[model samples]
Target: MMWRKVKKFFSALGPGLVTGASDDDPSGIATYSQAGAKYGLATLWTVIITFPLMAAIQEMCARIGLVTSVGLTTTLKKHYPRPVLYLMILFSVPAIILNIGADIASMGAVANLLFPSVAPIWFSLVFTALLLIVIIFLPYAKFVNVLKYLCLVLLLYIIVPFLTRPDWSEVLHHLFLPRITADREQIGMLVAILGTTISPYLFFWQTNMVAEDVKVIRKQVMVNKRMIIVAGNEADPRAREKRVMGLLLQKMGLDVNLGMLLSNVIMFFIILTAGTALFPKGVRNIETVEQAAQALRPVAGDLSYLLFAAGVIGTGALAIPVLGGCLSYIVSEALGWKGDLDKKFDRAKGFYGVIIVALLLGLLINYLGISPVQALLYTALLYGVTSPVIIAIILHLANNKKIMGEHTNSRWSNFLGGITLILMTLSAVLLVYFQFFNRS
Candidate 1:
């Protein structure tokens, strides 16, 4: 019975893991690596600080999806004023596509590291096409499983960090003590790391994945609901008890809050590993995933380099689909089209088309001679600026009684979420000020 229960729990896990792993995208890796190499453990506290907040936000997104049976875009359309929804979608859609474009370039960069003979542009195009084919043609279960395994690539960071033989005392001290630098560049990088880690794409993806989880649970509970509806006719107490158990299981499955916490914890560690290993050595400059990975080889040895490279390839591949898919979700949801991965292409033509188009456009962008490193920097800055708005919206949506019903955020959740919002807003402001004002 215990084994069976564990099996059931494992079976239920999906969206949370996917969203968490996706957080380690190439851009995120670059940001975190830069953070570690430059600041060392001084900024390590941010990872710990962000864990709960990231989890809370993601959980709220999942909850919104489970309760409403709608995607984030659909909920925004219904609850928020039209103009607000339109503005949010407008900012969100292109940003996601551009990020996907950056990911394609990043992934191609990884492939080039492995096979230097291949042109990066062609490599990016071929990889984009392959991603499209897999996502469009493969079954959802298979696709998710592949992504899950891809997450193992992140373990490379763990091994590499350990091999670096970081000073444990300093690592601990930095993890606990908050260090502030007046240097504008450092502050900007800090904000960039925060922005990329707790991003908008994860929000949309988490919510939709929750909705999908609900559909699965609903199918499993429909019979129980029917039994309860017909309870009076049978008048069987035992049957009613069984119905209640089914309902309970369904309720557990729909717990979006729990999902959010789980994903956030994972995010915290990924940042933590990077902060401890990369930041303290004065290895500040990083522009590409390859640079980040290559930096590890010197300290962590060839094995570490291999692992870092593998992690980049794995995370980059996993994120490429999501980066495109999330944009597709927003476009389809905004336009009021049937949008779901479970649906066949015929049923959701526009949805799939958007995914394909985003992937192709990303491919083209990579081929246009735009350096992946430059694209990542721009993407990070863009996300940093736009993140506060999305976070504010998420907080409002989560707290809204009309949307969340009885599952509205607890006072603690709201308070924490508020704090995160403020911090993110401040970071965005600092980043812009540094970029445009301080440097001047």
Candidate 2:
């Protein structure tokens, strides 16, 4: 029975798990590594503090998808003015492309470290082409399964912490304590962590992915002659629909909570590994993933260094597609064009077009001579600047009864999401302050 339950849970895992894995992409890895190496485990509190905040916001996005039967942009089109939604699409597409650019470059850099003979540029082109092919040709459901398996790559980070032999007492104290400095650099790092953690790309991705997941579920229900009916409220058709949605939401809660928990666990361990290995020595300045990996050598051994580098490639491979997909979904929805991954390329030309064009543009960013670390930091800062508008819109949608129907966010959901909104708002505020007013 236990085995069957486990199998069922794995089978139910979809967008949430993929999103969680993508959260730890090379950009996040870079930010967290910088945090650990520069500030030690002091930023460890973010791993815990952001879990509920991230999970809550994502859960709201998922519910919006499942309840509304559309992607986030589509829903926004209904409630907000056309120009507002368009501005969102405009801001997000470029930002997501930049994000994908950074991830691809990181992947290539890692490839170079692994295969010293090959040029990183060649690897970058090859990997970019492979991602395009897989996402373009594979059926959506199969692609999702491919990502789920790819997430296993995250296990690499989990093990590296063990090699460091960290002091459990200090680790525990740091985990629970909220230690922060008002120094501009520390504030900037915190904003980057928050931006990378609760990202705008994820807002669109989760909403759309959950919508697709529900469509698949309803199709299965139809095959079973159930008409997607509810168990409890069969008398009223709309109410029965609401009940059925409740069931979907319940399952989604499990998947999302597990995914977010897993994402944060990986985050915590990665920071811990870097902190234990790098901070005690005098090595604090790590600008790139490769640099951070090398910094681990004196304490964690050469094998750990190689594994750390490989992880950059793995997580980047997982993340680039998500960034690309979020762009496609936003543009496809904005254009009122058919766009579902399960649909054939011929059927979803606009959708596939957005993905292809976005990926190609992202590929172009590599040759522009921007270092991967610079790209990563630029991506974080952009997200930090834009995340507040997205979060406020999300909070608005979660509370709106007309859109979510009977599935409006509960008080607890509102509380957590409210916290997320305040946090992101504060980040934006500090970003403006440090960038402009504090230029001294």
Candidate 3:
């Protein structure tokens, strides 16, 4: 009975779980590892703080997808001005492609670490090809199922910290008591962590995933997707539909909360591992996933080293799809092109074409001589600059009765969403100032 319940619970978890796991990609691993090496456990508080904010924002996106039966990009195109939509695409697409590049580079570099004979670029080529084939051939449901299982690979991080036996008391202290400094490095790192955790690409991806999932569910409910909710009928049919939607929203909330919690927990442990293993040894500057893994060999042993290196490859595979998919969804939706991962390549050429182009471009970043670290930094700057606007738009969309109708944001949702908006805006400002204007 217990096993059955557990299985049922996991079965219900879909896009939210995948989204959360993908957030902790190779680039994010480098950010957390850098935080640990540079600031010790001082940054651990960020994981705790970001959980609610992340969940709230993602939930709003999910809700928008569910109510409208369309992706956020399409909704924006319909209701908002053209320039606003273009600005979103302009800031988001390049950054996402750069992120995909950094992840591909990191995956290749880490693969080379495990096997010295194979050159990193060769590994990058092989992995990029493998991802494209898998993404293109697999049906949407099957591909998502594969991604759900891939999320378990993050368990590697949860185990690495335990191998080193960190001090429980110190970990607890940093986890609760927020510790930050005013210096540029610390501020910039803080912003990077926040920017990475709550990204703009994720907003587009989550909304699209929910939209696709709803289409799938509606098909399952009956022959016609329109049966799930009747907009004009305010009597029994609409009321019954609202109840069904309420249950779905409840489940979605659980999935998003659990997924965000898992993401943050893995994040906490990655920082902890670096803090315990690298910080005390004066190995502070970790710019790449390879450096983080290599740094752990002596202090955290071969097992820890192996796990860290392997986790990078797993996360890269998991995350690059999301990165590519987000960009594809944005472009596909904006252009009124048919896009669904489950759809055959012949059916959705523009959709899959965008994904293929993004992957190929990402795979070329290493050959272009741009370091994974540099790609991530540029990605962070762009994400920081653009996320506030996206978040603001989501808040507006979620609360707008015209779009959402009766399924608008509750006061609690609005309160949390408001906080997320303000915090993200402030972080973006700080990130820009530190990266460019603030020399000191």
Best by TM-score: 3
Give the C-alpha miss distance for residue 246 in model 3, angstroms: 0.9
lDDT of 1 at 155: 59
Residues 104-186, model 1: lDDT tens digits: 88777777877889977777778777888888877666776676666656656666666666677876787788888888777
**What C-alpha lDDT values do all the predictions have?**
0.73, 0.85, 0.90
lDDT of 3 by residue, 98-190 (tens): 999999999999999999999999999999999999899999888998888889899999999999899999999998898777777998888
Which lDDT value does model 1 have at 30?
Answer: 71
Models ranked on lDDT: 3, 2, 1
Worst 10 residues of 2 by lDDT: 225-234
Candidate 3 — which residues are off by over 4 angstroms? 1-7, 223-235
List, residue by residue over 188-273, the lDDT tens digit for candidate 2.
88887888788889989999999998888778877884643445636777677667776778888988888898889889988888
Pairs with steric clashes in candidate 2: none
Error of 2 at 97 (Å): 0.6
Residue 92, model 1, lDDT: 74
Q: Who is ahead in TM-score, 1 or 3?
A: 3
Q: In angstroms, how far off is 135's CA in candidate 1?
A: 0.8
Pairs with steric clashes in candidate 1: 36-278, 36-279, 37-278, 37-279, 40-279, 40-280, 59-260
